[model samples]
Target: MSLLLEREDATLEIVDDSVLTICGEADFDSAGPLAQAGRHWLAEQPAQTEVSFDLTGVQIASSAVLSVLLVWVRSVQRHSLRLNRVSLSPALQRLMDITELAPLLPAVETTCAEPARDRR
Candidate 1:
């Protein structure tokens, strides 16, 4: 799994105050890097940091990965930071819907109007 955490499109222009944008895959194997990058950014910022997770590139994710993401979200909430603009895959969206995690994941937005076909 490829996980890249960097400035979007090399623009180098900060979109929001204390906001860190993450774009890449979030899965069991890639969750470590994603979590690490998020933690590092949070540590660098003072307070009320906003982390936007762009999941447009993410193709697959497991329950473990979802748990990891939830942990990060909780940490951000505890620190009073804002987690916004979270994009999710259709499969993940369904999982969140089924598990009633949509309320917890307020930052995540549904990109797919229809439910994804479950391969599992």
Candidate 2:
């Protein structure tokens, strides 16, 4: 049997009002770390703070990663915190469209300047 390995490179920046900008690869195996960091940041913030996910650097996101994102959104909603300013790659946007989850998440700006081929 062969083992599979997944790697994720992500950076988290805490903006005002507890909005955290997440940039980097959010893949199947890396979703856990990303979610953990997000949750940790939320816990550190005061009540009624928003957490914005910036996907400018995200190259690829698998279904698992999307699921993680949904879960995080739900958690934030439950806490009465707001979620805004989510960016996604074209591939991810397509996936969201296919799954009809785009309406649930915040509207994404389609200004990602990175080439599709360059993203991975």
Candidate 3:
């Protein structure tokens, strides 16, 4: 929707600290690739690694996304890995809340961090 600016259908990025960011829509058309990729990443996390799912840029989140998230949870448990955390935009947070799925995953409030200033 507006968050996508209709420019990006979906995007997947793995940033620093192994944060997996899923941008744009997390719908039927977009969930497959994400799930496939996510499974790969999740399989590798355990024994002192942290992985977070950053859905802050997602515009539309549907059952498809929710299902994928559920799969992630199962993966975490399956691998006995500690999920780092989940970061959600207000919209995504509300979507999870509406579906009563927020409690299923350990998510923290997505607050802006102060920019690091150069001390030169």
Candidate 4:
């Protein structure tokens, strides 16, 4: 895997030409740059490349993280790339479930070690 962008609390890396892995806290402060970099990277990939977003390393899965994910999703669509699956953290899965935005993403895989807790 090759490192693409690295901030203090977040890192975006290309697992291969086909998979992008985002690790750490993708907070509101990092959202804009993360989205822009992710979009640019997606735009550069060949259309035949199937894409996956690996967010299992993210802890918060805040709205900012979702925003970044959405931007990357749109970028993939615009580039005519196929989205395979989004590997998610437990927190991210919970956030998506709460927001009802799961359908906006492709197939999801909960990859984090900890399971999402029941808040209710």
Candidate 5:
């Protein structure tokens, strides 16, 4: 399913290997789009497979970005998906660290060009 958020500078798209590339600003304004698109992706996972979010493209954001990722992590766990290590931006890592959600999302620092790996 294509759950891309349509905006002037932001987007949420299925790039490859079930990785959703969330680009641009993810502030309170974009939070709903992120959450809605994310839940759609999570619910559609047919098997226990990794789901990655390439957040390297995020230029600006707020805690809503973390909220979106946290919700996705919870949905994956609740659905018994084989998900882990959501590729995140360094900024996002720092935010998660601040919020104490870094452990739950199992975030990794990597670009979207790199293979989205499900490192245990």
Candidate 6:
């Protein structure tokens, strides 16, 4: 795992060079730097074709956090990388649901410990 950006209330890191895990609280005060750092990290990774974001550690899902996620979405597109998954925290999920942005984010609800099974 590699540390990408660290703020007073949050941290961004890349795990196995593919999973970007964001933890703690983030607001408008920290959004810009977080987004900028994410872009830089994406640019530096030339061998990564797919990426996943683990936002489950986030404690505060503010609009600024959503903005950061959007920035990441755009960055991955600009870098010619596929966004394989985005694991959201309950707070983030509610924000996405309220904003009707779930479709845009491609949220993944499965855990990595086991294979995804059919519910029906």
For each of the candidates, the C-alpha root-mean-square deviation to the true structure, in angstroms, is 7.4, 7.2, 7.1, 5.3, 5.5, 6.4
lDDT string for model 5 (3-78, tens) is 4677765778786657877877878888887878877778888767777777777766479888887787777877
Better of 2 and 6 by lDDT: 6
- Over 4 Å off, model 2: 1-8, 15-17, 106-120
TM-score of each: 0.62, 0.69, 0.75, 0.87, 0.79, 0.83
Which has the better lDDT: candidate 4, or candidate 5?
4
Q: Where does model 5 exceed 4 Å of error?
A: 1-3, 106-120
For candidate 3, write residues 27-83 as lDDT tens digits: 897777777777777787665466677676666757887787777777777777767
Clashes (N, CA, C under 3 Å) per candidate: 0, 0, 0, 0, 0, 0
RMSD of 6: 6.4
lDDT (10s digit) by residue, model 2, range 4-117: 222446555554544445556767667777777766666565666655655555667578667866776777776777665666667677777789887777533323334333
Judging by lDDT against the true structure, name the best candidate.
Answer: 4
Q: Score candidate 4 by lDDT.
A: 0.81
In model 4, the number of clashes is 0
Off by over 4 Å in 3: 1-8, 107-120
- Each prediction's whole-model lDDT (CA): 0.53, 0.60, 0.66, 0.81, 0.70, 0.76
2 or 5, which is superior by TM-score? 5
Q: Could you tell me the TM-score of candidate 2? A: 0.69
Q: Which whole-number lDDT from 0 to 100 does residue 61 have in model 6?
A: 79
Candidate 4: segments with Cα more than 4 A from true spot: 108-120
Cα lDDT tens digits, model 4, 81-104, are 888878888888888899998888
Candidate 2: C-alpha RMSD to true structure equals 7.2
So what's the TM-score on candidate 6? 0.83
Total colliding residue pairs, candidate 1: 0
